[model samples]
Structure formats: structure tokens, C-alpha cells
Target: MVAREKLNQLKEKFGGAVQRADMPCNERLFVFVEASALKAVCQYLFRDLDARYVISIGMDDRPFSGKFMVAHDFAFDQDHLLCSVLTHLPADNPKVDSISDVVPAANWAEREIRDLVGIEPVGHRYLKRLVLPDGWPDGVHPLRKDFAWNQVPEGYDDTREFKFDEPPEGCTVVPFGPFHPTLDEPAHFRLYIEGEMVRGCEYRGFMVHRGIEKLAESVLTYNEIPMMAERICGICGCVHNVAYAQAVESAAAIKPPPRAEYIRTIMLEIERLHSHLLWVGLACHIVGFDTLFMQSWRIREPLMWIAEKISGNRKTYALCVIGGVRWDITAEVKGELRKVLDKLESEWTPVVAAVSKDKNIQKRTRGIGVADRALVKNAGLVGPVARSAGVNMDCRRDHPYAAYDRLDFDVITENGCDVWSRVLVRAKEVFESIKIIRQCLEKMEDGPLQLTIKDELPVGRIGLSSVEAPRGESHHFVITGENNRPRRWRVRAPTYQNLQAIPAMIKDQQLADMTISLGSIDPCFSCTDRMETIDLKSGATKVWTQEELLKLTRTKKT
Candidate 1:
């Protein structure tokens, strides 16, 4: 009943117009609807059914189907259902009604599709450049099949600066970045400032949009993309790696061994531990509490050692392969891991207590950067950003992946809906990560680490996976193709959605507090710059150590 009940409802509502449908599992549905009725169906699914909008994907289906494809993904969190309503329009008239009005979270997605795939979203309120760089040529959609990954078309203009919308009445302009001290990546934000208060802001980002999806679609093999995916972000590299591997596994119907699942879980949680610590310390540093920042990094240094000992690296462990994990936890490493967890827990408990009660930290963060429940729904923000706002949605629990279904950690949420609550949520989640790793260790069973597949993966099979990254949910979609590559690979980084909510979060807030506000979301511009989905293969990487970062911070302050 869980499988077909909702699919039946969609069929019953749309009748003959609901052209075709497929169910990948009991919890996932793919329905093909007529392009003309897409907006109506989207409204029905989003408003009437109360489904949460996930992401929208546009593809050039002309090579195969002589039409353009649009997929609006949604998750029914309560029902444990993930659905994609796919519609195809004729190549000559590639236009579909926009559902941004009905589901506000779909706004950036709609514009993104328009930018990359050349499909127009009719009635879109602001169809500005969302993904492409400032000087990209018009009518040259990069995601189209004919466009080569390395091709720069004729008539390209590299110096055409983006003209942002006019400021509100009596508001002075304050440019934040296309380079910021707090951000490791570049994104330009023009703030409409009235004295010290911010009235509005316009974002012009995607400065580093790399054609990774095109690379995957054109070049890489099935098992080789996991390493590339890890390059999405230094912080949540494993999340993307795991998400990409799981997507391929889903498409090929491959289930890794139980021990491999446990190993994957361990690596993911290890990443969460380091990433949360990094975020908390940065949040403190942003609020002028550099002492805590240094202290947190001091406590976090050992995890790097533990990770290097296990995976031969401090970060980008390259732990994921197509069917299973690349590394295993040995008895000696398990002993060391247990000791590390013990020390992490003991050292972290007091710090959590101190931050929770500290007046300066509380005053600096408590009411700044608020994202209420309404904004969470409208912007599709995930992870700590949404959870702190009383939105109890965790991909590990709601849409279980890897060994998460076998784990018993709680999804930490708070009702404060501010930077303070976000701090509490992440700080508490470190313990939860510790608990999950401990459980994985205890439940370990000696077995093979990966599956042996005798045949190539089937062509044209579709797969999708969502992993809970430290910042939020990192989602990947894949369509298997010939030459051992994906036909279309789409990535929706959590930052893409969460960053869109920044304008709303900072509105009417003090200009002085904006950095902490942005820092609270743990914005990873490199992750957001992932223009399309690409499977990342595990490989060598260079990561910033705590000492290096500390020196950099001190240098900046001086």
C-alpha cells in the first residue's frame, strides 16, 4: 500500500494525462506527466498533498526523445516517499509553466534549469542568471548534449559585469564579496543598507561553476567518479562520494556487504565530527570568540590523526567505490578508534556546556540569522539550518541510506530558529555522530568489503541518492548511459538551497552580524559551484590542517 497508494492518488487525479509512471521502490516514484499540466500537477502535489519540494532538473532529451526533459523532485517526509514528476516538451517549443509560485523552494531550481538546459520556465518571477557566470554567452546552454565540456563559444564576453537590481528607497549599497574573509570561495552579494541595518540583498554567485556533469557524461567510467565527487567540498567530500556511489549502486541494484555499509557509516560520521567541529569553531571565530575557535581546533586535531591512520589521509579518504567501501577497520584501528571516541566525548562535553551557558556567545548568536518554519519550507533548507528551526527532517532518518537504518541516533532539533539554536544543534550532533560510530563498531560483523559484479551496469537505468552532509542534504541523480558513463548526472548541493535562504535570513538584521549569520549555515561555495551532477571517484587530496587554519586566522586578524 505504501508503494502504490500515492502513485494511485496521482493517477486518480490526473487520469489519462498522467502518461506513464514507474516505482523504483516502495518509497520512490517516477511519474511522467504532460508538459502542459506540469504546473497544475506540481500545485496538486506540493499544496494539496503537502509534499516537500526537493530539486528541479532539466535535461536536453533531444538526442534520444526529440524533446526537452524537466524533473521536479519532491519528498513526502512523513510517508517516506520520494517522487519525481517528469515532463517532456518538444525541442522546438521547450517551455513549461513554473511552479515557483506554488512551491517557493523551486525558484532557484527553475532558474537553474533555464540557465543550463535552455528550457524556459514560463511565468517565473525572476528568471535571472542563477548558475552561469556573469559573461557567459546568451542561448549557449552548457548542459545541452551538443555543448562540449571544454568549448568556449564565439562572441563570449568575459568582462560584462552583472547588473544587480536597484536598491530599496533611501538604502545605501554595501558590497559584501565576489572575495570574503569568512568564505573560502567567491560569491558577490550587494546589500541594500539603510544605516547599519540591511533592507535587502541580491546574490550573484556560481563564480566557480565547473562542468563536472558534462565531464562525467562524456569521459569518466562507472567506478572512477567517486573520487571526483569528493572534490565537491573539502568538508563534506565523503558525503558526495557516498551519495554518488549509492546512486550508482541504486541504479545497478547492487547492495554492499554489511561490513562495508558499517565502514561507510563510520567514514561519514567521522566527516561529520570534523565538519561540525570546524563549523562550531568558525561560528565562534565569527562572533569574536577566537579563544573557543582555537580550543575547538585543538580538541579536533586528533581526529585528523585517527583518520590519516585509517585511510592514509586526513581528508577526502577516497573510501567509496561502486559496490562498497575501499577501506576496512582492522582490530588495531578499532582499538584506536574507540580510544579516540572516548577522548572526543570527554573533551567535547565540557565545551558544549561552556558554549551553551556563555553569555557572550549566546548574545552574539541568539537572535541573529533566523529561518522560521515557513522559510524552511519555502527555501528547501536542510540539515542544521532547517532542524534548528523546529523542522525535524533528517535524511538519515527520513530517507535512510548506507547503514543509517541500522543506527539508532536521534535527529537533534531545536525551536529557536536562530544562529544560537543552530550552534546547539551542531554541537549536540557531534555526540550523536560519536554514538553512531560507536554503534557501527559494536555491530560489526566480519565479512567481505565489496561486491563482485560480473557484468557491466545496464544502460539507461536511473538512480538517485541523498546523503546528509554536515551542512545539509547533498543529493545526486544519475542516468546510466553507454561508454560506462552517465547520460545525465545532476547534483543539488545543500548550499544551493540553504544559501538562497540567506537573503531572507539576513533581512532587517544588523550589518555587523552578517558574517556570523552566513557562517552559521556553513556555506561551502565550492559545493554550490557544482553546476551539474558528477560521480566522484576516490583519489588523493590536499586538506587544510587545524594548525594551518589557525595560522591563517591569526594572520587575518593581525
Candidate 2:
């Protein structure tokens, strides 16, 4: 929300500590704040300056600093724009005072830092093990450069210590996922059902902790890492890849040409459209509306076809490179994309009307999974989930990235703050994405897509890139130079942050509605692949390991 001029004023206020400010096609000013003032600066941004804390990224330092560095990113709604205020924290004894006091949403990001980087955000009320097992070693942060692979430290234990137990009276807790019949991604949730009503809930995940950051530091070059990181989340492939590429470009102080920008935007919107359509199908399934679900996915096939034709893969498109993009949209390809768009635009009205008027859908999703605006804001919800709850926050419209500034679209908002509203927001966004794509097609001109750059990048360089993925904002941080590969890279999938609000939204809803509500969040468990069962009355917990379950099932079969 910070204007160009106001950002300049803020930069002037900080002077030297504010290193290398650039607005990057997006309205956001990538300001590198000094470590000393991170907490205070975040407080100022949230309280007096209208910005709210989004999330944090921790990365390894290359030459200038120590083993790692951290950036606490913030966004605001002053002019309904998404701008960032980044604070850099040194890796040695990397400690920054927690801003949860000013911005409650910092809690999960702080927990992530605790789990992955071993950096303690001082004053975080609940800094227990999150995303990692409790028995995981203290100093062996997975995101750090020093973490040893293929070997556990001496005397290290594999067991985790769970903190919660025992549901309240009248509450019947149901443990759904790390793996579930309905879920496509792995994440665990304990739903407290009071009869049919959900009194409260708890979330636990991160089973698929592949050490992507550490892996990027170890094996891949800068150009290669984007392809590698794109696999971080199967659904949001373009988001992660594009953000990572942008981060590296920023660190290297290079900009992709105008043609590349337009291509990136087109890809981004196409991905967004595809993701939302998939969510629509999932939501319909949750309500047992198979016909609608089939229709939604059937409509979605063309989008996937386009992704395959353009990027050569349906899921993990290796389309992005460090300097810019790996491929360009040709005249024939552009014409084909336009044809697909025309089909999509024509279907929009009928789909929206059918979803809106369906009595069965109304019965299940109308008032289910309601979360208060304050609750959502405090949890730091992002993307469609936040916007559905009347948050009025969209990283694309608020933070103009790629070709967003040159293109036009509305930041769709819904004040309903319920499952139905969230569905509506996504449905509306499908139209807006089509609108943006049409504009891009109309205005796109011929030029070079990827700019040529030297193999070696500048040393001690750091860059941050955030794009509005289908679900929400996907953030990437790159740390490395001369090597043209990041010494350390942090990838924050939107599901990493938005999962916090799942508990808040499903509370007091019915057991069946809980299923519907879960679908509303459009979950992608980027780090986790499984679930844990907890005692409803006593909170006693037990993780049903996959191998154990398989063994038990085999014995029964025998």
C-alpha cells in the first residue's frame, strides 16, 4: 500500500541501513532493513504505517555475512497495493525480536524459522516444534548451510514431543490427514466435533520436509534451482519457479526484458486460472456433487492442455530460468492461447450461475466454515481464503508484479467470511484472470524473452520475490552470487502460511461441514505427506506411521 514517493521517504528515513531499494514492476519496495531495527521497524509498519505482517524468509549468506540471513516481509492496504518492508537478520546467533505482539500473524512464520533455520524469534509465545519432529536436533536447522545430510548427529532421537492433548467436554475430536481419503496433499488436522458441531480444531503437518533450501544450496546452480524448486508444490509450479527465478534475478541486479515480463504474467494467470478451477472441482466433490465436480475438472482440462503445449509439462513446468524465462510464447502459441481463453470466457457465466443457484451447494456451503474477519487477519490468512473472509487482500492487484501494472483487473473481495463466500471469490477470480489474459494477449508485443547474462553472478547478493499464486502469495528468497547458484534459498508456499487459519475457520461447524470447510481452504501440504491421531477427550496422541499401518493391513489380509 506504500506509494512510490512514500517508499522513497521511508528509505530516506533509514538511510544507509536501507540497502538498494527497488520497486520491481510490483508496487512493493524491496527494502533491506538493518537487523538491529527489524522488530521496531515491523511495529512501525503495522501500527502507524498501515502495513500488516505477511511472513518471513530465512536464507544462507554467501560472502558478506555469516552462514545465513533472514527477511521479515510486510504488506499494507493503504492504497490497496501490496508493498514489502524487508528486514535482514544476521545468521550468527540469528535472533530477531518477535513482532507477534504487533502482528499476530507472525506466529507461524516464526515457528517455521524455528523448525527449519534454528533461529529463535525471541518473544514468540509458542515456539514449540512446528513442521519438524520434537526430537529433531536443536542446531541442525534444515535450511542452514551447516546441516549434515544422510547422517543423524550422535545420540539424536527420532521421536517427536506433541504439546496438545484432551478435548473439552462434549467435544468429539476427529483426526483427519497427514493423509486422508479426500485429501490430495498430506497434512494432519484434529477436528473437535461437539456432536455434529465442530467446537475447535488443531493443525499439524510438514511430513515432506525435503530440505529444499539446503538442497538448493548443495547440488543445483541458480538456473537449475528454479526447475528443482518448481517441484516444491505440484499444483503451484509456476508460482514457486517464477518467484525463485525473480529472487535470483533481483540478487544479481538484472531485469528481464518487457517481452519476458508479459510472458511470465501470461503463465502466472494461466496457472491461477487452472488452480482455481481445480479447487472448484474439489469443493464440489466435498459436498458430494459429483456432476459439478466432473464438469469443473472437465472444463479445467483445456487449461492443462495449454500448460503442456506452452511449458511441456502438465504439473511441474520447467519454464523459468534465473535471468528470465526459458521459453517464449510464439505467434502460433499466442493464437492458440487466445482460442482457449475464448472458450473459458464463454463458460464463465454459466458456471458461476450454476454454482450460485445450486440448492444442494447452498445447503452445505452457504453458512459453513465461517471465521471472523479479525480472526482471519490475526492468523495472517492469504489468497482466496483471506479474500473470501473480507480481507480485501490480493498479492497480484495489491502488489503489481510481472505484467500486472500494465494489465488491469479488480482485486475481488467478499465480506461473507464463510465457505460459500470463498467459493464465490474463486469463481469471480476465474473471470478476472480471463480478463487479464485477454488484455495481455491484446497488448503483447514481439521481443526477447530471456536476457543473456554471464554465468557468474555478483557475490554477497540477496533478493526476495513474491507473486500471487492461485491460493495466495508465494515467496522466494535467494542467497548466492558469483556461483550463479544460491548458497541458500527459502521457498514459502502459500499453504505454508494459510494452513494456520484452517483451525479458526472450521470451529463450531458440523462434522460433515468440517469436510466441506477443509475443501474451502484449497490446501496443498507442500512439506507434509501424512496425519496424526489424537485422543478426543484426553488429547493423548499417536502417529499411525504408514509402515505400521501397512504391516497391520498385510497381517489381516494373510
| lDDT scores in order | 0.88, 0.73
Clashes per model (N, Cα, C within 3 A) = 14, 14
lDDT of 2 by residue, 437-547 (tens): 889888887788788885578765656677898988877766664455666566667776667777777776667777777778787776322111111222223344655
What is the C-alpha RMSD, rounded to one decimal, of candidate 1? Answer: 5.1
Point out the worst 10-residue segment of candidate 1 by lDDT: 533-542
Model 2 per-residue lDDT at 554:
85
**By TM-score, who's the top model here?**
1
Q: Model 1's lDDT to the true fold?
A: 0.88
Q: On residues 26-60, what C-alpha lDDT tens digit does candidate 1 reach at each position?
A: 87788899988889898998889988888999988
TM-score of 1: 0.94
List where candidate 1 sits over 4 angstroms from the true fold: 532-558
Model 2 scores a TM of 0.86
Error (Å) of candidate 2 at residue 464 is 2.2
